[model samples]
Target chain A: MKKLSILILILSSAFAYAQTPEEKGLEIAIEADKRDQGFADSSSKMTMTLKNANGDESIRKMRSKTLEVQGDGDKGLTIFDQPADVKGTAFLSFTHVLDADDQWLYLPALKRVKRISSKNKSGPFMGSEFAFEDLSSREVEKFSYLYLKDEAVDGEDAFVIEVRPNYKYSGYTRSVVWISKEKYQPLKIDYYDRKKSLLKTMTVSGYQQYLGQYWRPDVMVMANHQTKKETRLDFADYKFKMGLSERDFNKSSLKRAR
Target chain B: MISKMIKTAVSCALLFGFSQVKAGEWSGYVAAEYRGFTQSKLDAEQFDKSSLSLSFEPEFYHSWNGGDDSFTFVPFARWDEHDPQRSHVDIRELVWLHVAQDWELRVGIDKVFWGVTESQHLVDIINQTDLVENLDGEQKLGQAMLSLSLIKDWGVLDLYVLPGFRERTLPGKDGRFRSIPEVDDHTVYESGAKDKHMDYALRWGQTFDDWDVGISHFYGTSREPRIIPTVTPAGLRLVPYYDIINQTGLDVQATFDEWLWKVEVIHRSGQGETFNAFTGGFEYTFVGVMDTAADFGVIAEYLYDDRGSDPAVAFDNDIFVGGRLAMNDAASSELLFGIISDVNNRTRFYNIEASRRFGDSWVLSLEGRFISAGSMGGPFSSIRKDDVIQLELARHF
Candidate 1:
């Protein structure tokens, strides 16, 4: 009976008269979003390796926590653990679907909290190829989608879709993503700049299932086509359902994020 | 009295008890600095146009009870080659924190920072200034307090009972940055309890959309002192006199895309004259300049003091214009350059700070300050030829 229901779902979604390619794309995105919701909270270790055009590489390590809000977007905190100069510094971000995200930084030396502008969508993250735009949680409502076609990624069947950011201040014009058909996860993405030129490409790999329900990528690498720089992120030590609440993501918590 | 006794006992315990708790974290740095001045010595008691110093700071942190309770210890020490007053030891932060569902309790010594302006921080009154370290007055001596914070959906309200006031450290006559008629060893206070006088403060902070606001009130001994001339056997010396007072402060900051607007205002009564002062500015950033990852910011701020000319206070009737540059590279290099000009006089102060990291454990910093010759009153009147440049390198552990 479960198999039969799954078959019916696929058939109806494929042949629904009101479902144009755009609607199909949105449906696919919504379905993907639904599959990843309700984890409550999670913590992980993140390491980023940045390589410049001359092939010089620098590494940064941080511990991260994420809390999922019911109706709004998620809240995230990252504490720097390496590069001893910034050891105790922390960054806090509250993301929204349409409006600009709110961000704050805690400077350890001064023991001060500074609110920073979040309009730097195309700026580098820690001087890496991954821009701040690439690090925010992708909400389904933040973009308009169009179903392009179906293809295979890493020998797995995938769907190709074109997405344009609905927000006006976005540094990106459009992006094409290849999402796994079976897992409803993104396998790769190609970002376009405001001039509609190819800007960067990100490849995701090392898929691992957490709590036997959620799919997470363990490795993500971004290559900038214009600057000839690259950044690779390695994620590890994933813990889910840590009983995190808004209390743990508040401004007071930012001071002791470590 | 009982609470004070308990605090002393607990501090002794924490000072020695931390070694046994081996599962904690440690971080700090040791630095060596070299300062060179542009002008020669003007007085017989003054040192040469160069100085050297070494500083060390170490921190230890431990948390237990499922991360609900924590303790922190930080000690700072400095050794200056020429000035005895600059060589000292201090407890920068030695505090214990307890986190509850909707509130927090903190005790022991720590530092609290307030205000949001590039030119000056008028509302930051919790910690006394560590003046011997730098002329920018950003370094602070640790303050002992009993603090309680109530965190709610609307905002965070903090109450503090402060004790054990630390006197501001001053450079002596032999020091390079000393004002004429150098500070004497004696200090006078209006409060009968002197340095032991208790103080109180409260602050409520909240955020609305793009705006962040804070309103705070402080009642106690003033952190800033009034300079009084005294005749002594050695010579004419300037004595620091602390007065009982009340101060109210309001600070607001708004972040709008590439533009950040900030303002800090304070009203104080009790010291020489009751007056109001304000400083506000905006920073407009050009992100990704010239198709590079570097960002350049232009900043301008106006400072106003109702009293007009007070020597103890800088930034009175002044205009501050500055620029900040961040080279978004792996090395994390940055630069800040500014000039504060007296609107009514020819007095101008130029400042520059630049820093960059090397590898994972080291950083190099350069700072330069130049006070041009002109008509500025108070302590500024004596330091006309004190232009200096300093370079420092530190290694972290």
Candidate 2:
């Protein structure tokens, strides 16, 4: 009887160990979120490709400086390329925690910057397939997450998690995410629209270690399922912890930005 | 649809004379186009133009179901060859309306246009003509209006008050073709009475099974200037005032089976002069074109002015014939061909254009125009028109 009891305890310990794979995947995802949560950095260039319902594709390239202060959200200067009339114009956005974000766009011809409000977020951006809401910062608290499963990504184990947004204005309802177990970084996410249908798929690639403890993705791609339009963000020449503050985000300082 | 709370709120507001809503629908479109002009006259001239135009067309299409209300604006502009093309922008419609079961109230910028003809002097007042049809035309979006109607099985009776508009400035003429100037805040005439900007009109129309017909009578202020300053026998400029201005007209139109016809006659009271015009046109579906549906249209018009107005302003009083040919299919966005011949001036204008659509978001257009003759002289002094070519890419949401 003593031997039998000892054997049972040993089996229980083995079963608990076997569940570590999934448990570890969850921890990695949580750690990755923490890493991104504290990041404050700026990037220079990004290219986005969009896929349409017909399988044809369109590309939107933006040349801009993006300053992202995590938890506090992202603010940036964006310039559009291609259309001659809209060239040289600039855009700015500042995301706040407890309130709606504020945005502004400078039209060169008008020679003035116009403040954009909540009413206009659903509208198109310069007649592009993208909406103003799509460009705003994604607050971490805006969503609630649930661990779904574990799977291999690129031959490495990953954890699958589903997140549902809590915002009312969001065009999407839920997103399914795949996070790398070992690296504690998100690999891909599938966005579902209001009808709970797959609307867009976002992929994170080129994961690079920054500051030894930070795992940052060098590229993020978001593709719209209906419009066949995509946007790609390529992080380059990132400078972290430059002592950026709220003073730098003022409208008066935007014009002096290089 | 008005909700139960809104109905209660609206009722209380009406009872207390409260007006204005914090939320309303505002929508508009803008066009910036570039074009080169080819002259058909002697000393053929070429002009190139890049224009940016914007319009704010807000419509209050919805109101208290039983309340009389009105609001709409359609403003537009076109810069041509470094000068402002005929500016057609205006506070097109602003009506104060009261609605009762049997009677509806409407006041301000209201004109009833009823005609099937492409160019209707009689019914073209309500809406501006499609831009593609008139290359250089004076269709200013002007006039003050008042209309009252009783809705019926056929149509409604509408009354209006019309206003003479400040003449829109066009291009190609000295003092005419000037860069789009900032809009004037005010203006006065030489009569010491300022611009006699207001008049009145009454009209009625009915519609039946794809057919609509209407007759309208207008009594309004004339746009014709009463005084002209000219150089006289002594090499001195003198001002002459003329009262030969008639300020009344009649208009009629009908539409059926995609075909339209219209007629207008204006008789001056002082000068005993008359201006009459008639127009007919139609659009038809052309099948068996590359297995996709195609369309084509044609228009012809005639004019007779007993006054024989000067060649300088064809819109005032003159005889001319013009027609348009339009074709569209899966192969192209819109293919248009057109010709206009001035009978009195002995000049002609023609153009061909092709436009294409990209994805469902953008439009790319290519167009060219040719003028066989512009100036009367046939040599170096004559107008040698340069081909006007334009390429416009636009995206709308």
Candidate 3:
């Protein structure tokens, strides 16, 4: 009887060591989030090139500023600087963990600040391949994760995980992300539509270190699988600890944005 | 004339300082439009059955002193082949702005917009309505003012000291949207200072969570003039009587996922009798409909007034329903269709506006408006036969 009891204990301990896919996925997400903390604020300039299936291209230039929040989602603002038609247009966003993000748009032609309807998050951003939600700060709490498996992407070992958005009005049903094992940064993401069909694939490359601690990608490309369209964002002029505050991210500041 | 001289001097100064400026921007659009009326010419003096128009708006921005101080100049002009009233020129914006850490100061003519409702802008009263530009009253004539905006942790506060008043432009006799009796350009003022009266306005706005709220107050000459009939040498003309009034307004919007709720209310005093009006609406959007990169939005609103049918405004008691479609394509195609109906009468107004970009620099737009048979004495009674369709092509530079 004593030998049988000891055998049962040994088997239970082995079973407890094995984690479910969901738990493992969540653990990986938590680890990534932990690694990305302490970036108080940052500012950068980006140029986006959009290409159609016909290989036609258009470019847009914009500047972005972000403010990191403790125990909450971050805040961000983007100001369009080029494309004369959209010049002086600004967008402000306040992301939340468990709630819909707040967004406002300043239209230079009208000289008015308009609050963007939250349901429009799934819409395209400035006619680009990216959605408004995609441009926002991605909080770990905004999704539920499921670990898929370990995969190698471009000769680099990566962990594949699937994330389902927890918010309503999401245009995508699920997204599979490839996180590099070295930096725990997102290497690539595949978005799926409501029908669970592949919609778009986004790849991040050209990683650069800032402040000797933070890693940021200098180039991101998103290709629409169904439409055969693509958008490439080239980032530069990264400045961290810019001292951005909530006052700089308000509607009034949108008018003063240059 | 003095304003023109000042503008010239400012232009010269800007040109002289252009070499020292780090950056500047210039943008404008030239548009040509054709309007076709559903009805033929009513009289020989009236405009032709169809008309063509051209408009141009050029804007220039120059930032100096390391972007802390800037100057913006936007001049607009339009020419109509048939209606002289529609052929006009105005300075849309000419402002010198100074920005500080927590406050901003702007002086000169500028346009200010405030409100959240789609059907009507009840709380937007800073600028005078440019009536001849559009029948929907969405266009505004710039006003000269000294504005100071303060930013704080609680909210944003804006104070305006308006000095010059812009008269409402009225369509000429040959125009399509004129009243039965044309409005006289000569205006009467209830205030002793007439157009020189220094108007004042204040607004406080803030956003918290999903809610955006604003409260504003304006005290000055009313933008909406009372139409009084006067016997002229040939016929009776409607003269505008600008009354001194005080108005308080409130606007609020709440965003919840895919839904937006908006409300605008206003109360005005000193127009013989005080009156209150409100407009409330909601917009719901469905994104990526049918697996395509298209969005569809449904909008509904209710407009009410304390005086009901006897109210001065056109939308005293009405209901509006609209739908917006966005293609989310490279061309940025959009279409909006709406209908406004009288709650107590058999009056309905339908509108459809569609626009799409041809390329990086060109855009084309089409608009149609129809009015159904309505009871007498309503706002649309005079223009009920003026259903029209318009097409416009614009080139941006």
Candidate 4:
């Protein structure tokens, strides 16, 4: 009778710990999503620095804006701002289901807009070795998550959650995310491959609040373990609630925009 | 011409296997170019003519390993209008190729050119060259081969055998129209030595962190030297006695940090004579942008005809130095500029070309080639220059 009582007490404590982690992780993920969902009042521009294993580096300036509708799925458009050859080129993302997404690019020389098929979503973009899927939306439903453990991140109490991709076509199979308990923001993420091997790691830093209720990360760094390549994306000058439309995302509109 | 066309069509149809029609698994494109030449003051229309260049390459692939492993075949056809404007269809490469996890094999007629030099000196056994008074052309093709390759973690080794075909010979101006002068008459045309007729070749390659290394060797007859003839030393002969058959060769290439280097050495011995030749060069991309890249290449090559051993063949030594610039855009256009310096006479040959890939169905190209032959040899050998321009369009299905 005494042993049974001890076992029941242990089980209850374990369940309590599990609930705390899931709740903490959901808070961080949801808070970040809410801030990233809105369109900017004006067009925003940012510079990104990508470093490779050989110590080579590339810098890309990008212009991005959000579309009008909140749930229409075609929510964003990004254009390349540097490199004379690929300048004025635009990429559109649509059909943003939790499972699959569609994207396209308009090339100036060919004077044609090409629909990028799903089969090649995992391949490198513009021969830079970064997969197209890496640049897409990371919807919450795209992964199945479970709280792993409690840890200290950036000198703050944090909850670590393991997130596994639910779709077969995803380049990474699993990722471990560390969320700070105080701010409910991601500190670091370790991405895993199909072989269950660690492939890449991403770390977020310098979180800044915008528009009183919204929080934005100043920078995010993604590094490929095997290739020793790294990409640093810097976000700045963020605005909220701008009006954009589907017609603005069309191929013909790419030429007129600055 | 008709027979060559029929053979080429049959070979292409066989290599492609006609499966794309049923499986719906193929995509392709076609290209062509045309050229017209103005006769030099030294040689009239006899050496100059309007020429057309057309090429068709149909590619086919069969998937295996859940589509990871595949068999890819690219068979090409080229038609050129030679002097006197006889149409020639060169079946450049037609082979059945297979690529798996660890093996690659190719059988049938094909061209396997290995080297980093703009002008191949040692490993150019599969093409033929045409010679004019002021132009130097050596192109090799239409040879049958069986090759096997094994892939390793860091490198690959290829072994191959070639049968029935070789290089076309060009004689020195002094030794025109001689029959097997530097080679044996019997071996040149006897046709029964299948044992020695088969050419053996081996190439091994390894890629390093920032460089690639390759070594290859071939034992066979000289593709160019088969006929022989006796000629007097002169400054104005057109067709020289082509001898020096039964040639063996070795080639090497190394690519390092955006730079490519190559070397080739050839030795020929047959029917009482021997000669040695060597060539080397390098290529590198100097300018690379988003949609375009420019490659600058240069070569210093030498060919020694060592007729000093057999006075009967009677020849003079010749050397050449050249450079070429090739610029290409990712989408659909390319431009090439080339210059060759004839060391024997201090003359020069220059060529420029521009080509565009049109839609998915056709391609168009324009080219201009010029050659300046100075007063190098003959009594009437005044400064002669030939300028040629061309435009062509081609389609494929």
Top-scoring candidate (DockQ):
1
Instruction: Please provide, for model 1 over B31-68, each residue's C-alpha lDDT reduced to its tens digit, 9 standing for 90 to 100.
Output: 99999989987667988889999999999899888888
lDDT of 3 by residue, B1-397 (tens): 3365356436644744545555678888899999999886544567767899999999888888767788877888899988999898887787788888899998877899999989889999999988888888888887888899999888899999998677788888888877776688878999888888999999999888788999999999999888888998978888999999999999999988778899999999987679999999999988878877798999999998886746345787899999999998877799999999988888899999999887677889999999884787677776777889999999888
TM-score of 3: 0.92
Candidate 3 regions off by >4 Å? Answer: A1-20, B1-23, B309-312
Best by lDDT: 1
The DockQ assigned to candidate 1 is: 0.73
DockQ-based class of model 1: medium
What does each candidate score in C-alpha RMSD? 3.2, 18.6, 4.2, 17.0
- Candidate 3 lDDT over residue span A1-258, tens digit each: 999999999997776578789988998999989888988899999999999999999888899999998977898889987665677889888888877778888988777888877677678887899988777777888999999999989998999999999987788999999999988889999999888999999999999888887889999999999989999999999999977777778888787787
Separate DockQ for every predicted complex: 0.73, 0.01, 0.55, 0.03
Q: What is candidate 4's local distance difference test score? A: 0.54
Ranking by TM-score: 1, 3, 4, 2
Q: For candidate 2, lDDT tens digit of each residue in A1-258? A: 999999999997897677554454444545766766655655555554544445565555565555666556577667765333334367777665435555656653223343433333433444343456555665556556677778877777888878765654555677788888767777888877667888777778898876666676778777767656565666666555665554445433332232
Per-residue error for A37 in candidate 1, Å, reads 1.0
Query: Candidate 2's error at A4, in angstroms?
Result: 90
* Alpha-carbon shift of residue B208 in model 4 (angstroms): 4.6
Top-TM-score structure, candidate number: 1
Residue pairs in candidate 3 whose N, alpha carbon or C atoms collide under 3 angstroms: none
Q: Candidate 3: what lDDT?
A: 0.86
Model 1 lDDT, residue B255, Cα: 93
